[model samples]
Target: MPFYDYECAECGVFTALRPMAASAEPCDCPDCGTSAPRVILRTPNFALMEPGMRAAHATNERSTVSPKSTQAGHGPGCSCCSAKPSSRTLTRPDGSKAFPTARPWMVSH
Candidate 1:
């Protein structure tokens, strides 16, 4: 059985479950019992994104440097890209730091 949508003059809109062969047949409005003709409806388009994927997409959108901007050297004394992306001055305590590569003490390589 396939679901069908119908419009009734006195009852607005209603749904019905019917065979494909009888999908085009008239439907009775549940409230008014009036015979109403079936109507064609457009299917809905939906996107289901995982939490991590959605978060990553949002982060990418809000990135400080865009592909075009970074390629043209948006920062001072830099073009295309630099060996270093961010600089850190550790006057305060912050765990977030960037190095070109991990040191021997940081990880065994």
Candidate 2:
């Protein structure tokens, strides 16, 4: 059984354990007994994809390499979060932004 969230406008939010097939069905509010619709909530996912878990495992294995290097933005392959080492970041002129560049592969956040 999976725990699901149900919200009643007249009452409040409540949780109930039910089967996956009944997840979409309305649940009775414990307080007012009114029908409450199920609400979607984010839950932790224990299952990992093939290459995804392997990469995370490899990174965890390197935790013993260096104490300071393990810090985020300073470790190898952390260039995405690390600074460019430049004295100052370039400023965008005018009201235009450089983001979502003209590249076809890039997307706006």
Candidate 3:
């Protein structure tokens, strides 16, 4: 059984647990016994759920809607996956390498 919202003429709004088949049918208000039509007041009651349970449900829903893509591509010029080395060492015309800011003992690879 799922909870559904109903708007009574006398009362503002009320919730009732009813079968899915009777979801569209008007429900008798619990307070004044007036037949009220079903209405959508809000989304599912996830706030009332436990923190861990709510996280699990969110993960499940996210996976169902959009699974993480494993084959995302990076461009050749992109720094993260580029073949070029990003070393800050400067190369002189004499073929010697100069490490301006690097530690003296740090050897270039």
In terms of TM-score, the best-performing candidate is 3
Put the candidates in lDDT order, highest first.
3, 2, 1
lDDT (Cα, tens digit) per residue for candidate 3, span 41-87: 79888998999999999999999997775435754456775568678
What is the number of residue pairs that collide in model 3? 0
What TM-score, computed on C-alpha atoms, does each candidate reach?
0.39, 0.40, 0.45
- Model 1 — which ten-residue stretch has the worst lDDT? 88-97
Please give the RMSD of candidate 3 to the true structure.
Answer: 8.2
lDDT, candidate 2, equals 0.76
Write one digit per residue (lDDT tens) for candidate 2, span 15-34.
99999999999999999999
Between candidates 1 and 2, the TM-score winner: 2
Top lDDT hit: 3
Residue pair clashes in candidate 2: none
C-alpha RMSD of candidate 2: 18.4
Model 1, runs deviating above 4 Å: 44-109
Error of 2 at 79 (Å): 33
